[model samples]
Target: MSETRIVGLRTERGWTQERLAEVSGVTVRTVQRLEAGNDVSLDTLSRLAGALEVPLRDLVAERAERDDTGNAGSTDDIDDTGGPAAGDDAAARHFADAARSAWRDIALGVALLVTSPAPVVLLIAGADAGLVPTSVEVAIAIGLGALLAIALVATLHLVRASGRLSPFLPIRQERVRFGARALRWAERLEGVHRRQRTRATAVACAMWVSSPLPLIVVALIEPGRGQGLWIAAATAVLLVVVAAGAFTALRTAWAPYVQAKLAPAVEARATV
Candidate 1:
């Protein structure tokens, strides 16, 4: 009922929510809400306390604050001053940034699954032959499903790698206007705008480059005397264009030309 226990325990140990979450097997979001005394589940509190290297009873203990009746209010009602020591705003920010990156990863992964040659091919090809899947159509469906599975795993893992040490390293912005908030509201909002543009632009651009996938697939599926060579040649050209775009995405130079979008499929992972 009171976060004073959580706060007092955290302050005593000097652990950030991120650190706490790491040890607890609980998500940063859950740790955050618990620290606010939001009536979280017992399992969640057990994890949070474990992450803080404290007992659940210790985390639930009352702090110095007390009402006239000698009863303490809900910990969520406490001021920031009563929170973690050093008030580690940077730690809070990092948690938020990590969350933002996670959601972004999911968005991009979904987009990749949608845009990947496999699924796009099935949707475009299958709809034409009607929903009744044939043997060959079923095979195509299986491949498409596999693409989505791979994309999902990549997105989920890369979500953990958005820190300064992350591969898709963030630009240093100590004084930048855009930043994560303790509440994470602004982060989610901004991430949404960026993701929407990222998908729209990547799809529009990929559309131009993806024209050859079907052609290449056709050539491979029904290789004739020289069809494969023709398809391969066209694929090579598309690859060149894609490579250039990829470089631009890496350099963030494409941030403008593609309506301020990075490549949807490529992920930057943090080594840590």
Candidate 2:
């Protein structure tokens, strides 16, 4: 094995240096020094191997090879300046994909919940204004039925999305850890997403705060002319705009939110 194989193994398993340190009962600096191709004790090597569930020889192979060749500067040896191992990229991609899925599910489910009452509100208002042929009592019944149906659908949607996101939840991913390369990647992605999320949230808030404008505008223009129908239309529009805004904000913010939530875990691991 090459000198950087320890880094390879740890990263391939999605274990950060700090994670390895915690599991192996060593310091994070020790893990870092070892990966930098610095010499460490046999006991440390044994602990690492055990923590990684690999044989001790796997951890010592590079040292053995170097001793045999009396080569301290072999080309295969990794120095502090070496680039990250291949596993880092794969881990980062996996994390990105997972976060994307989680956000999509969350946004869609909440959007459904938010907009579920729009149709019912419109139907009742239309009936009250004689805009619909149905009697007010029948319209109320239909609206109630529609409300129940939409609520049920929203519940199912949320449950299904939650199922799909279960693996990425904090409790399930508690033991999973990220390396420095992955953390840097996450930070960069978070920075880009933070801007998007902030913009989305601002837009959403503006939409929500302005949603009542339609009703006010219509009432001021003509107080009694088709007032019921106009009020219903305005309410329906408000629900839709608010739902859209919420979905946009949630979708854009999910990546940053997830990354922030994981920060404390990394910090704890480092201090360990």
TM-score winner: 2
- Which residue pairs collide, candidate 1? 3-75, 5-59, 166-270, 167-269, 167-270, 168-268, 255-260
| lDDT per residue (tens digit) for residues 26-45 in model 2 | 79999888888786653455
Over 1-272, each residue of candidate 1 has an lDDT whose tens digit, in order, gives: 56666766667778887876776666888778877767665335434543554543444456434543468554432233322211123433443444454545444444443334444344434444454355555656765677667666656645543331121221121111121232244334445556655765575577557756756665657665545344544554554445434432333222231211111101111110
lDDT for predicted candidate 1 compared with the true structure: 0.45
The number of clashing residue pairs in each candidate reads 7, 0
lDDT for 125 in candidate 1 is: 44
How big is the RMSD of model 1? 13.5
Q: Tell me the spans in candidate 1 whose CA falls farther than 4 Å from its real position.
A: 1-61, 64-77, 80-88, 116-138, 144-148, 151-272
